[model samples]
Target: MKRALYQRLTELYNAYVDTFREADGKLPPMMELKRIHTAHVVANARLIAEGEGFDAETTHACDAAALLHDTGRYEQLKRYNTFRDADSVDHAVFSHDIVKEKGWLDGDPHRESILAAVLYHNRRDLPDGLDALTLAAAQTVRDADKLDIFRVLEHQITTTDWRHNSQAFWNLPTTARPNPVVLDDIRSGRPVAYQDIRSLADFVLIQVGWIRNGLAYATTRRLCAERGHLAFRRDFLHQLTDDPAVDELCQYAELPTQGVS
Candidate 1:
């Protein structure tokens, strides 16, 4: 992958998302949210790639994947007006389709593996035995994506009430008590699944788990820590409930970055 090609892909992504803008040339809030997010994910990917000492082409591939990872979200919103995969389409798979159909990565040397990263990013598990290049791209984008999402969640909840950010909160019931399954998932060092999230607190708790075990790189852990993502999530949960397990799960986040990939 060439840096020039990556730059072209970035331009293409920007112009594509521009189609979602309203008459005033302002993207709707949700579209703007994702547009900003993709930018930061690319920035975050750059940090991780540099910290991990990736070679030039590998960094190029990872950055391209990061920029294009959410390509389908704009189309998904236009078609269904919802980000919920169950309510509409799986954004990740849709993103892969859009990028492929557009031939954005057509001549890149590592096209297939980069596309695989985009395709499998939202899945619960990646297929085992991926090539080193494919694994690098996939892990970089996933880790970068999750790390920034914690920031986005915290910002939306803090700047506005959950009632106003229904898209972010997914219409979950307001409750102080988190679902036992979500707490148990964290307690056992497992990432919480979407179906398992009950209250808004449960959703935050799942992101907290990402700090502990879900991150694929030590650099990601350090970036998340530096950004205070864990502290915000932990503090939010503490305000919501007196559950002692909140502290227990948070302690895991403080532990040294566990076994970076």
Candidate 2:
């Protein structure tokens, strides 16, 4: 069943790629992002499920859910030309809507939960009362998604051309100082603010902070650590330790970490 599902998924992905290329007259802005990132999502999700000792059936659900999590981004971007979900409209909701409209998910064995997972994966918070299966798939996809963002950003920081598209995401100033949100998040061991991030370094750390908050599976965490982002964790902490603004944020939040050396 898993093998068959995988093959079908590959075919669907191939079609999505063809359609995407036709729409943009080129691949999406990032290099091999959709293809490589989707593969990472599936591979990480499978490792997460296997490490958690999930049944084969659950693993199948997770694999389908992870690969399809961003399935709507292609259509959404083709229409809107931007990846900001809130600005273009919620991509997750758009994904669910498009899947129904196009009947792309019709008759798939894991269709219902895969749709549910894709719909809920990028939410600011998980919905109340999610069933175990749905919740597991959602969390798996979220972790895998964030992990791949870390990889993409890590690559961007080193590659000049990658940084060009990345810097344009929020229009960071070339002369901007370090983003204070980066300092505060590290001090509190939380994720950084999304909107105010203003540099390649800040971008990379925010991606790192996702592990500090979004990770749901031990396998996901272990893989992130193995990727050497664990040290980046300390880099943020070091920023917090020295920055007064970060100390102030801690105090304002009344978090215990605030004001402590």
Candidate 3:
């Protein structure tokens, strides 16, 4: 039963992406980035579900949530030309509205749980009163999203012509000094807001900080350890600044040590 649902959800996701193609039948560069990111999130979600031993039905619901989690990005970019929620709209809310309007999960028995997971996946803090299943699904989506984000940031920071894909850089200046406020947020273990990011370094620091706060699943931590994501960030920050404080902050993230295949 859940397998059938997964198939339908994949079809819906493909159809949705098709609507966003440019006049030449290609996605705009940023839109293309989002398209690929969504695919990775779906794959990561499946992996997380399997790693954590979720039941078949719950796993399928998570797969659905992951596939549709960022559906708002296409419309948000088209309408506002920005992915920063503070500059435009709360993408999680927008994504929820899109899924609800499309009636994507209209008749599924797990519809509300799926929708609730999608709605809160991007939140800094999950709301109170979510049932155990709903909370687990939401956390799975969140971990999947963050895992892909680490990949995105790694590419963005390394590529020479990243400027050509300015939206991926969030249009921030590529200066070396991290914003003090942003650094403080990381050091003090507080959630960093998008609006507070004043430079590219601040953005990178925020990503590193997310290692400490953004994670929700043990599977995610294991994957990060296996992927060497934690090591990559630590080294990336060391290259960015020789400050001992930054090293301490990176150490505080406490990512796993085992290598993932």
- My TM-score estimates for the predictions, one after another, are 0.94, 0.77, 0.89
**Cα lDDT computed for each candidate against the true fold:** 0.86, 0.67, 0.83
lDDT of 1 by residue, 117-174 (tens): 9998887778999998899999999999998888788778878776545556877775
- Ten consecutive residues with minimal summed lDDT in candidate 2? 252-261
Scored against the true structure, residue 117 in model 3 reaches a CA lDDT of 89
Clashing pairs in 3: 226-259, 226-260
Where does model 3 exceed 4 Å of error?
Answer: 161-168, 171-176, 255-261
| lDDT-best of 2 and 3 | 3
Give the Cα-based TM-score of candidate 2 against the true structure: 0.77
Candidate number with the higher TM-score (1 or 2): 1
Error in Å for residue 200 of model 3: 2.7
Stretches of candidate 2 above 4 Å error? 22-32, 161-169, 174-182, 189-195, 198-202, 232-261
